[model samples]
Each structure stands twice: as structure tokens, then as C-alpha cells.
Target: MKIKIPTHEDYQSHDGLHYYQLWNSIGDEWLCPACGRSKFQIMKWTQRFPNTPHSFMGWVAALHKHHDHSIGFFEPGQTRFPETLICGQCNSTDGVVKRMLNLPSNFSFSPQEMRTFIQATPHGKHKINYDQALEIFNLRATNKNGIPKVY
Candidate 1:
């Protein structure tokens, strides 16, 4: 298959697949904010997201661009950057948590939230408790006005 990986300058001016592709293009030692897993770490997974079958080759080493779907948040002055780089498992778990919790379609867990939840709960392979995750999801923010949310 000839998948066209987007270059840093060739990506679109919006978010979504392109953002993740851009991150993959600029591959580095990015750590998943949730599990602290490295991009190059040799992990195993059969899927990246819902309904998506993932191969255990290059796909396992790919990092995902995790961000709040509703907020359009990112590093200040950066358009293509996501809030954080997360491993496929971590990012996939977020989707499972959101779906099971019935969170708003646009609701996305921030990196801090994912980190706390993963640490506090015994989650593996995307199995997490709704009530516990919900509580952490609503945790009070420490960021003050005029301060950008930093990981």
C-alpha cells in the first residue's frame, strides 16, 4: 500500500489525522503522558482505535497526537502541534473510557487526566471504571487565566 505520509509543511491547516501524521513525520523520543511509554518502545497491540486493526510492526512504535477535541488546544504559537504525544494504547484507552462513560462526543481527556487515571486505577488493555474516571475527569484545573494549559 502506498500511504502518503504527510510532511511537516505538507499537512493541512486543521486538526485530526493530519496532526497525528505530522507528529509521526517528526518522530522522536516522545513519551506518552498517560503511561510514560516511549514512541520507539517495543509494545504490542492489535488495534490503534475503534474498528481499526493495527499491525504489530511499525504501527506499534507510532505515537498519537492527543488533544482536547472541543478546545483546539496546543502549544502556544503552534498550529500543527497537539497537546501531547501518546502511545496507541494510551490514546485507544481514552476512547474506550469516553465511550463507556458516555462523555460528550466532543469531550477528550487531557494528558494530566489520563496520567492520573492510569496511575490511580488498575487499567490495562482499555478496561477502566467509569465512575473513577469521571471523578478524575472533573478534577479542578490549576491553570489560571492567561496561562496556557501545559503538560
Candidate 2:
């Protein structure tokens, strides 16, 4: 079955500082259970905010490895037990919700799917500095039954 991944545009964009604040709010560290990697990255875009100079228009938080990336998908307003965890490396799938219980261990998003879901947003569309829009992806410090934890 296909999973719904959040596009950059799906991120909250109330203000230019919103994405950065969101990223920081998520926490400051993340770890990949399969590879024990701790490096994560975030991307954000800026656009005019009605009368205001500019605000964050898009954002994405992803786990970064040497040759691949992954993102977490959880229920809206729910932080524990992600619906699915898609890992680009090894194309592995970890079912985090009951509906995904039947997903194959090897199920993974394709290159095109990654583009459409994770990397389709264009950059440099506004005047925010790259540093201002980007940040380190953070994971929370709690443990769910199946979801990975950030430390």
C-alpha cells in the first residue's frame, strides 16, 4: 500500500521563523536504528506573508546518511507510533501503525516518490538566508512501542 509522506509545502508556514522554530521544537538530535546514525538535516523555504516581509512557506525534516535519506510520517497531532518510517538506505520499511502491519520489510519509496514527496520543493524563492531557513532535524526523547527514538 502507498503511504502519505508530507511534502515540503505541507509544513506549517505561518511565518519565516516558524519552520526554524518547529525544527528546534522537535528536539536537537535523531538516530537511525538500522545504522546507528545520528546526523539529520532540515530544509525550509520562505515566501511573502501578507504585509509582512517574508515567512517560511515550506519545510522538511529528514534523516541523512552517506547515500540516502529518510523521513518520519506520523498521524496529525500524534507524535508516538509513526504510521510508517521510510528509509532510503536499504529500502527498508518499519511499520509504526496497525494499518501498516502488512507492509513488506523491503517496501520503500522510489526515486520518483522521494522527489514528489520529499524533495520537490524549489529553493531560493524568497529572501531568507539559507541558514535562517535550514536547521538540524530533531526527534523527541520519548519511546513508543515501534517508533525510533532521538537521543
Candidate 3:
């Protein structure tokens, strides 16, 4: 199934912000805009301060799902590119896969670092493996902030 691709005019009319608001406001369940799938997921990444491991990431994507349509709060000051909107099923395609091929390797967090992170926040107490932390960290690192770049 194909997703509705917004036109340039759509972006201009809203000054590039309305679409996100509209998507977030959908009350009833809607099909995935990318694959027409009924199932949708919410993804989130957090940036923690080294000193306290507190989420220094400010209010961000708080009102809406991640650009990927995953439901979760995103790091403040991070931007979501158009590529993020692609569903997981579609992400493996040749051209789309290449877009993420250049993503940097996950940041390595030492055991000590993990401990420090866990100690800083209430939610940190939950068991989170290194891979999981690394994935979120990477997403936080790569995400762009403000209006998504139109390509």
C-alpha cells in the first residue's frame, strides 16, 4: 500500500508544521500512511546528561508520535527527516536501506556508564540492555530538530 505523499503546496500552506499536528490529532485508529498497515508503532530516543543522566532533552515531540509514527517522546532539539516516516516493512528495500547504511555505529556505553545512567533517573531502574540504550542513543544523535528538511 502507498502512503499519501504531501505536495509542496501542503508544506507551504502550513508553514511546514501543520501536517505533524494533523497526524498527531487523529483520534481513531488509522492505517499506516507508509504501508497502509493497521499496525503502527511508536519509537523514542532519550538524551541523558552525563553528570546526572537526567533527561536533559527538553519538551520535544511530546505532542505527537515520532516522525516514524512510533508513539513516544523524542529528544528535544532533534529533528525527524522524511525517511523516518517509512515503515519497518518498507525500510528493507534497496534504496531506502542505503539511506541508513551510513548511520554511525552505536555509541559504546561502558558498564560503569550504564550504572551511572541507571542511577540518575526513576525510569532507569528498569532493566535496559546495552543494545536498547545504544539504539535510542543513535536515534537521538541522528535526528534533526525543527522542521524536517524537504528533499
- Model 2 vs. true fold: TM: 0.19
lDDT score for residue 119 of model 1: 45
Q: Which has the higher TM-score value, candidate number 2 or candidate number 3?
A: 3
RMSD in Å for all candidates = 11.1, 16.5, 18.4
| Per-residue alpha-carbon lDDT of candidate 3 for residues 48-120, written as tens digits (9 for 90 to 100) | 3446846474211112222332223243343333323322223322122223344322222222223322212
User: Cα lDDT for residue 64, model 3?
Assistant: 20
Q: What tens-digit string does per-residue lDDT give for candidate 2 at 12-115?
A: 43232433443344432543333232223233232336466665454334332222223333233333323332222312222221123332222333332322
Query: Candidate 1, residue 83: CA error in Å?
Result: 2.2
Best by lDDT: 1
Worst 10 residues of 1 by lDDT: 8-17
Residues 75-98 of candidate 1 have per-residue lDDT tens digits of 344333247767666777788887
Candidate 2 clashing pairs, residues 3+ apart or interchain: 15-56, 16-55, 16-56
Model 2 stretches with alpha carbons more than 4 Å out: 1-16, 19-21, 31-40, 50-151
The candidate with the higher lDDT, 1 or 2, is 1
The TM-score ranking, best first, is 1, 3, 2
For all predicted structures, in order, the TM-scores are 0.52, 0.19, 0.20
